[model samples]
Every structure is written in structure tokens, then in C-alpha cells.
Target: MSTLAAMIAADYGTIGDILRERARETPERLAVVMETGEAVTYAQFDALADRVAAALQRDGIQPGEAVAVCALSSIPYAALFLGALRAGVAVAPIAPSSTPGAIAGMVADCGARLFFLDAGVAEAQKPAPVPARQIALDGSAVGEAFDAWLAPEGATPAPVEIGPKHPFNIIYSSGTTGTPKGIVQSHGMRWKHIFVGDTIGYAHAPVSLLSTPLYSNTTLVCFFPTLAGGGTVVLMKKFDVVRYLELAQTHRVTHTMLVPVQYRRLMEHPDFDRYDLSSTRMKFCTSAPFSAELKGEVLRRWRGGLVEYFGMTEGGGTCILMAHEHPDKLHTVGRPAPGHDIRLIDEDGREVGPGVVGEIVGRSASMMNGYHGRADKTAEATWTSPEGLSFIRTGDVGRFDEDGFLTLMDRKKDMIISGGFNIYPSDLEAVLATHPAVVEAAVVGVPSDAWGETPVAFVAARGQADPEAIRAFVNDKVGKTQRLAEVRFVDALPRSHIGKVLKRELRETWQKSPTT
Candidate 1:
């Protein structure tokens, strides 16, 4: 037996250890591949991580210190992410799409000693005063070239004793304008994810195609599992439907994780059926509300298991709806995963029974350590049970069916209360989407003199549809209290990078132009 293989056989607890083992077990297997055709073998991938760790150590980055990277998905970015974990350094992956102020705030918040970014972000974030020394990942003149900054070939990183509580990476909450709070996920949390992947066929050395940005927790849930299982990860810097179909056909990708909007686009594509996706073993969706209609379409047309995960990035409990297995339960996000405890509590923090709409609180083994440097915020987000077990409050309002399936109503903050009547925006949005002339819709509560608050809808129409006519149609279908007071036409609804509708933006726009 190989020496490295024997070492890994004893125990491969961490991600870096798993990479080392995969290099020894399948040295020539493709570890990562870019949409542009750049690829790396497991052996080379391990070596690159080692170099990154060595360089950070040489620069006096202690095990607990952090580094930040803001760039598009690429080979070097992926390696640097894993390498930092190897050196016991946490990574804060800021989105390049974020405003310059948000980027600067995150870099400062994480206390990053070295900021690694591509030329594009460097150019965009000029004069933002990044506190750390910069290293250019794309060899741009904005900072030192990545290759030149890396430790010399054949260099080795000092061994790091990674513990369960060690910070793996800091994922900032999804927001484009503000400096979102950083969620500090420990190595133990990630290990749970990898283990969960094994149960769902991620251990088969699958070829996974990923289109989501590396900065998202939505991507890492799939990305880390594929790599840990010695599978090849094919990344796209940006998502294009035709390009995605072509890569899936060419690579025979076995697994994928796309947000609901991406799936809707693929299913609605003109030639979606022409692509051969028979090799797919599973397709996962998360990060947004997936409508039952879209899930049905995917199950009918796509050739794989369809699973929708309902949870938060802060790592509370997760509910997995295996769509193929539970066709009748398409409206519900499945039961809480094994060993995960999910509960519902009223506004007063008292536990509510099934069939009652309340805030979703969950507890599990795979929870985040806390919000970085925000103890008050962390405490505010947590709810202590009678047994003193802390649960993460999801801020989502949902109810459990008789069979224990969860049906999400809407975000707690988004629920509209008009004259003491509670109205879920999703309920109104669902009816609006069914209108023949409407492409999509969003409903937000607007100020009202009589009702205190009233429902108003902003819709993206298929073509020239009369706003009054559509509003009348919807009001006729829903109850008087649930009816929309006004309908405004928009070319498109504002969305975050992960495809969540920015309801705050919609509300702000309405407040600015309250002509109606």
C-alpha cells in the first residue's frame, strides 16, 4: 500500500486530508475543470493547495488569521479556498458583484491579512481602501501575480492540527448593497455536509457541473462534496443555459445544484429536450422558493432524482423534498432531515403545534459557530428550547402538514397585515403568475390610510397587458382582505445573484412613486 494511502486510511477528517487521500488514490483523476477547458488532476490540485498554504505561512499568516478572495470562479480561486483551510486559515469569499463599500467593509470585518482578487474586481473596487495587501489571481498589475506570489515548487506547508471547532470559512449573508454579517462555519459543520453527500450518491466519483458563484453557500454544499468524493467539478464563471446544456452533454455530468430560476430557464428553453442528460443521478435546488409547477416540469422532462433543500446558510435544520419520490407533496418542502429538529414558534416565542403558521426554528448537529464579532446579533437569531438547546430562527413562517411536511408561507418580515388580516405575499404572487399575460410577479405591503397596510403587486407582463384588468382579475379570485390594492407593470423584478426577489427594493420603489 502507498504510504500516503495508509496515512489517509487511518483517518481523513478534514477537507485538506481528503484532498491528499484523493491524490494518492487517484492521482490522475480530474479534480477541477473550467468552462473554458482548463483542468487540473488531483495530484496537481493537492500540490497547488500545499503551495498556497506554505506561502501564507511564510508571510506570517497564523492558523487563526483570515485571508479574503473576491473574484470570479477559477482554478486558482478554488485552490486558494482549500489551501487556506489546510493552513488552518479561514477564507472570506466576497462577491465581486457587491458594491465597493460592501467589499471594503467585509475585508475589514474579517480582518484579512492578504486580499486575493482578480483584475476585474481590483479595477472596480479602486480607491475603496482595502486594508490588506493585495495579490492578483489573474496576474494583473493591480497586485503581485498569483504564480509569482506562490511558494516555490516542491515547497511544503507546515502541518496544521485542525480541530472540529476551527473556523473553515466565513460566508457573508447574501446582499448586493450592504456589508452583510459573516457566518463563521466550523470544520465540523463542513464534515457533516460531506458525510450527508455520501448518503445521496456523491461518493460515486461523479462529474458535477456547477454554475453558481463560489461565494455562495448554495455552491459549496455541492462543490465540497464532489471534491471530497474524488469527483470532477466543472465550473462556469457565469451561467448561460445553452452553454450549461452543452457542458452537461459533453461531460456526462452526474450531479448538479441550481437555484429555482435557473431550472425554470432551462425547462423553458426552446431546445431543452435536445440535450442528452441521461447520466444525471441527481439534481438539487435550494436558496429560493421553488414553485410546485416548476418542480413538476423538471421531474417530467429531466432524467434524474430531483431534491429541493429548504434551509438557511447559517446552518440550522434542513428539509429535503425528494420530488421524484413525493410527487403528491410537491407543494411542501419535505420532512426535516434525519437527526434534525424543526419547530414552529409564535410571535411570543411559545412553541406552536402542527398546522399553525409560525416562525421556523431548527436545531441540528451541523450549525454555524456564530456570526463573526456579532454576539448580540447571534443571540437575537437564536431561540433556546426548554431543554436549553439553542435553535436558529429561520425568519421564515411555515406550517407542518399532518404528515409533517413543511409548507412555507412567506418570510416573517414580508407577511402583510391589513386590518388584522394576515396575507402571505407568496399566495398572491402564485395567483398572479397564473395569469396568461403575466411572466412573473411580486407582492409587497404598501402604506394605506384605512387598512393600515395593503397589498400592492409589481408584475412583469408577457407583453402589453392592462394593469387595471390584471388587478381586477386577481382581486376577483382572492378574498377582499387578500386582494391587491394596485398593480404596477415592470419590465422585470429585481433579484439578487442567487435569484431571490428583493422585496425591499420593490417596496422602496413603490414608496418613491406612490402616484396611484
Candidate 2:
């Protein structure tokens, strides 16, 4: 076998093992750096992780148990995550933006015996009852400070056998009212992600800046691999366009991941052209809709390869758009990634032909094991092929072009139905986006007495544009079935933590309006 094949097939042991190897190979190299001006070398980070693992074992954290971290991004958070994996424990990194009730409920649902929180999160959630012992990531008067909770510096935990089937982490899905669904990703899945850069020229000492929250899977795609590849990762507690640019220039950052909204903010920054980003090698965007215009703008101004990834936290299939290489396919999400079997199925569950819109379903080696403790929900999220292959259902409506590139047409739940005709909100949104005054546009279905449901548009504009005129302009461009029933102007669209427009909030606001 070739050297590359041997590396791919070799057992990487565990995340802990990888860190140990890097520490041994490059002890003095920086492993992690935070915006707070604190940095840790590979040897220091590995030792801290070992101390964390030893501490967990000393506290009776058994193998396969869940350890929940509901805190802001910090070096301790990173150490805890890797340490949990070293102890054969699965880490559940809950979103800090989540409400107190939601956080408490998720902690209970995950059955985590140990909970870690930041000072702010601990204070906000003090009213809510927590079952587990709480440790504070930041030095706070919470349950215990992270420093106090660590084992002795030289202590080592008992080794536990780890296999591919072992759960590495459980990423809870966002936008849940009650307990969110925990997507259980196996060690093998993460291992695949770690080595994805082997053939992509990531072996070089790349510096990655993680502006998105660590709790998000969007950040992990680039964060984890950079570490496993012995690269430096700069962690930003919160994203600021000016600070990001300064850091990128100072560190000569080569790789980073940002959501679409961040890209928009960076591009629109007053001093966008003032920074030197020539050292950037690869930039990735995911977690929300990225308009072709925005992609084109980034490609023109940014000094690196821009790739867009379309997939879910469930990890069924991934579509990668190398915008630099395929400029013509900027509007599409590119073709299915290698080893990913993607298919579009109609409402009746029959496979659709090219150019026919359908719901995307796919099977891949990296697919999630299942939603933790929710078999029925897991089954509902899965689909079986005619040939008995299991696939995860992505509730996205899209079509494949002649070149096998996928063009998304709004989400299935967001599809507007008027006069018994299906209307994709993306089509209408695209028209609204073309308006010179519009900065961002979103379309949501609202109840209508005459058509059962009708399309309504919400836009953030650059100037005081008349909503009625904008609505009429969009209506003239779209078909009669897809015309907007109403248009409203807002300073900004309500977005999730990861930049997804919350159309449901728009629908609720519209329904509550007296004029409606």
C-alpha cells in the first residue's frame, strides 16, 4: 500500500493520543492561543488535558459517561473537551446562548454527572435547578474554579480502551424549545474529519482562527483538524470584524471558518481593505445560506481558497463548493463529496431525476449513530432506500443540475403554498436580494384566507425604500403563484446564533400584526 493509504488506514488511537504525539514531536510549538494574550504550547496543552482526564477519573467519571460544558470559549474548555475524550467520556458542549431552562433541561437529558459553566452562564442559570456538580471555567464563585478541579500536574488517569464505535461527543441541535436532540458522533467520524486535510495540503503548519463558538459544529470542522495536524488555533471569545482582521494579519493565519453573516460583516467593515490577509490559505463557510453574490464578493476580495460546505450536524452527507475552482457553480452547493451517496427523493419517497426538486437524503460513513435517547425521533430522521441502505433525511428542498451540482430551494418546512401550488421562498428571496437597496431578505409563509398560505417578505435595507414598491417589483419578477402577499422592512432579520434566519419568528410577528 502507498504511504497515504497506510496513514489513512492506520489507527490514530484517540484524540488524546494525537495530542500526545504532537506534544512529543513539537513540545515548544504553540497549540492554542486566545485573544486574551494567553498561549499554551503543545506540551502544556497535552499535560493540561492529561490533568483534566485524571481529575475526571478521580471524581469517578466512568467510561462512556457524559460531561457537559455550558461555558464560553476558553483554553480550559478545550482542555476539558480533549480530557473527556481521553477518559473515554463523551463531551456535550451546550450553547451558552441557550436559555436557563433549556440549558438545565439539556443537562438533565444528557444525564451528565459533571457540568461546567462560565461565570456569566452560572449566574444566569442560578435560578434553575441543576443535578450535577458544577465547575466554573472562568475563575468564578460558582461550584468550583477550573484550577481547583484539576488533578495534580503530573498525575495520569487509568487508560481506557477506545474503539471506533465509542462516542466522542454529542452535539445538541439548536432551536429546540424543550430538550434538544443530541446528535451522537462517533470517534471514527471525528477521526475522518481530523485527517480530511491530509490530501488537501493541510500538513503544513497552518494557523486557524476560530471566531464561531466552540459549541457549534460549524467551528469544529476547522478547529479540530488544525490541532490534529499540529497547527495553531486562535480562539476568539466573540467575533469582531476589526479584531479578526488584526489577528489574521498578525498571526499570518492560514485557515479559518466563519458563517455567512460574519463574512457579510467583514466585507462591509469600514476598514475592510485596510488589512493584510495575504497569508490566508483556506477559508470555509457553513451553517447558513450563503448567497452567490456574497461568495463572489469574498472570492474577489479575499486572498485564499473559499470553500462552502452544506450539511447537517447529523453528518449524513457533505457537499463542498470550491468557489475558487468552480466560479461558474457559485450558485450551486457543488457536487456530493467523495464517498457520499446523495439522492433527492420526492414527497412520495421516490427518487427524483436531475433538475427535479426533492428532499435530499444521503448515506455516508460519517453519519451519526442516532439521536441520543430518542429512538422514535431518530427513526423519523432516517430513511431506507429501495436497496435497504440506510440514509439520513435532510429536510432541505433542492435539485441537482446537469453537472450534479445541487441548488437549494429553501427548506421543506419553509416552502410557501398558495392556491395549492408549491412556491419556494428562496426564489422570491433571490428576487428581493437583487434589489439595489436590500441588504438581506427573508420570505416566510403566512396564513391567508383566500390562498390558505401566502408568501410575505421581510427585508433589511440600506436606505428608506418603500416596502410596497419593493413588493411590487419582486412580484413582477416572480410567477403569479409565488408573488408576495406583503412586504415589511426591518433594521435586521432575526437570526440564530449561527446566522440562520428565523423565518418562524417572522411568521409569528406577521400573524400578530393588527393589519394582518
Candidate 3:
């Protein structure tokens, strides 16, 4: 067996160790390339990681301690993340787009001893005091500069043993109010993902392009696997349609992970067809609901295997829908992955038979440990089965077909009860997507004295689509109970960084101005 293959086949391994091996095997190979033209060799990346680890250790950071980073994707940030892992420390990657208070709360909640950020985040978060000592990822005056903070280049960190159950990262969910819950993923969970990557296509040293922020698990799923497989990583600090196309063509990127909205925007861009993306071997989408129409479009126009992963950052069960493999099952999110037991349960926690709509819950080897420091919240998210197995409650309502394909309805909390019928927002959104002029749409439950609760549509339209006309088109197609009571035109839907339409914000807008 090849040395790399043997290393990957080991019963257990940490990402840091695998990276060190890659550096040993292919020192001269490109490890990372930034959009701004900076690049690093595998050897250089490994050395930098060593220095980072050594520095963390020298500063009295212990194993199992955490560090916080809020910065745009860059080589230094990536190196620091890897370095922390080497020192057996967990990383809390805060979103730079978060409110200053949220950023400060996350740093404190994660119990980080050091916080690293760039100039932009430093300036924006000046109003909120970060609990940890700050270091600047960029050479700005806000904190100690990264270059100066590094342990000398030749320094090696004291060896530390990393176990499977140790926290790999604490990913904070985007909460609308209060502090977001931190989902603690383990090294074991990440190993499972890395193994899956090898089985799929990451073993080929393919050039992977990532446009999403480093703080997102959506980005790391692709990021970690590419590095583990010794592939070159191409990062975009921010996504731009033209720039994305240019990079894809220039880098001949073979792998990528994009959210559904990104796919929609790229496919709709006028210059999309101009780029040559034949080198792409696999494309992944997750974090938000992926429309069947968009999946079909990607399959038709994009080269590579278009796979949509359905799961949560908490990592309960994952559904992989390979659009290219199952054209007939485009509407469904595919069957449960091997070894992943997915079940649909009624509101009362009773298992439902096939073809019955219920809350989706799943159990797998790749589950998260728990929500960091929130045992009560963690318990709320889990449901124990009759067999005494714990399953993560997806909070998503779906039905499993006889063939085992899972078709999502909507979030259980987002279901609208108009007169007594359960109206799924996705059903309305799907109808709106069929309209020739509707670019994108979101549906939310609005207060209605007549129906108790009513469906309202928020739509982003093309050139000159009338909101009333679009509403009429959608309402005509849906059942009476699912019909929209009002339609509001929007320039674009408010979305989280990972492309999930912020339905709560839409609902708030309707509540604030019901007539509009």
C-alpha cells in the first residue's frame, strides 16, 4: 500500500499529524494559495504550524484550552488554526460579520485565552471588549501583530497527545437573540469526515477552491479534507461572481463546497457560461435548504459530481444527494448515509411509518459531543429512541419514502398553521421559484386575525416582475390553506453568511408594517 494510503487507513489520527506527514512526503508541493496571489508550500505550511504551536505553548496555553479567531480567510489564519490543533487546543472561529456584542460573547463563552483577528474585525469590535488577550492576524495597530507574535521559525512545539473525543472546534450557531449555542465537534467526528473525503475524491491532490468564510463549518468540511489529502487549497476572502469564475478557470479547481444561494447566483450570472470549469471533479453544498431546481441546474450546466449534504453543524445524521447519480430523485435529499440511521417521528416523539411526514431525527457515528457549556440546550436538541440510542433532532420536518429517500417539508418551528392545516413554507417557495421572473423567494407565517396565522411571501424579482402578479401566480398553484395573504417585494432576501434566508427577519418586517 502507498504510504499515504496506509497513514489514512490507520484506526485513528489527528488532522495535524496527517498534515505533518504530507509535508514530509511532498514538501515542495503547493499547500495554499490566496486570491491576492500569495502562496505557500506544504513544507512552509508545516513549519509555520510548528511555530504557531510552539508560540501557543510558550504563552502557557494548555491542551484542551481554546483560542478565538475572527478574520477573513488567509494563509496566516489557516496556519494558526492548524497550529492550535497541533497543541491540542480547540479553535473558536467567530464570524467577522457578527455584531460586536456577539463576537465578544463568543470569545468569552469559548473561554479562549487568546483572540486573533484582522484589522477590520478589530476596528468593528472596538465597542465590545473581548475577554481574551488580542493578537492581530493582520499587521494592524489594534493588537500585537501576528508576525511578531510567532515563536521563531525553527521552534518546535512540545509534543502533546490528541485524543478522538477532544474538542476539535466549537462552532456557534447563528442565533437571533441572546448568545448562540456552541456546537462542540470532536477530533473523531472530523476524522470520519476526512475518511469520507478519501472515499469520495480528496485523495487525488485536487485543487480545491473555497469562497466561504473560514469561520463556517460549511467551509471547513471542504477545507480540512483537502489539506488532509495533500491537495492545494485556493481561498477567496469574499465571494464575487466574476472573481469566482476567473479563479475557477485560472486555478482549474477540481473541488469546491458552495451553499445553495451561491450556486443560484453563479448559474444566473451573465458571464457564467464564459468560464471553463471542466476540471471540477466534485462540488458540495450544505448549511441551507437546496432547491431541486437549483440542483438540477447545477447538474445540467456544471461539470463534476454535484452532491448536496443534508445535516447540521451539530453533526447528527447526514443525507447525501448526488444530483448527477439520481436525476429522478432530485426533489429528495437522498437516503441516509451508510451507518447513519435516520427516522421520522411525530410531534409526540413516536416513530412514524414511511411516507408519513414527521420531525427528522438521526443517529450516526459522527455525532457532536454536545453543545459547549449548555447541557440543557443539548438535551433539548436530542431525542432518545426506544432502543436507547440518542439521535439529534434536526428540527426539520420531512418524510421518508418507501425507497428511503428523505423529502424535507420545512423547519418544524417554521410550519404555518392556517385554519388548522399545516402549511409548509417550502411548498409556497417552490411554486414561486417556478415563476419566470422570480429570482428568489422566502415564505413566513404572519399574524392574521382571520386565519390565526397566514402565509406571506417575500420575493426578490428579476427586471420588472410585479409583486401582486407573482403572488397571484403562486397562490393560484398552491392549495387554499397554503395561499399567501400578502406579498412583499424585496431587493434581495436577508441571508446568513452561509446562505440561509433569515426567515425571522422577514417575519419581523411583516409584523412591524403589516399593511406594507
**Top candidate by TM-score:** 3
lDDT tens readout by residue for model 3, 1-516:
967778799878899999999999999999999998899999999999999999999999999889999999999999999999999999999899899999999999999989999999988998998988889998888899999999997999999999999999999998853469999999999999888887679999989999999999999999999999899999999999999999999999999999998998899898898789999999999988888888988998988898889998998899998888899898999889988999999989999999899999988989999999999999999999998999999999999888889999999989999898999999999999899998889999988888889999999888887888988898888887888888889999999999988999998888788864
Model 1 C-alpha lDDT per residue in residues 158-186, reported as the tens digit of each score: 99999888999999997633459999999
Model 3 global lDDT (CA atoms, 0 to 1): 0.92
lDDT agreement of model 1 with the native = 0.92
| lDDT to native, each model | 0.92, 0.88, 0.92
Candidate 2 per-residue lDDT, tens place, 84-117, comes to 9999999999997888888898898889999999
> Which predicted model would earn the best lDDT?
1
Alpha-carbon shift of residue 128 in model 2 (angstroms): 1.4
Q: For every candidate structure, what is the RMSD over all alpha carbons to the true structure, in angstroms? A: 1.8, 1.7, 1.1
- The TM-scores of all predictions, comma-separated, are 0.97, 0.97, 0.98
Better of 1 and 3 by TM-score: 3
Candidate 1: stretches off by over 4 Å: 1-12, 176-179
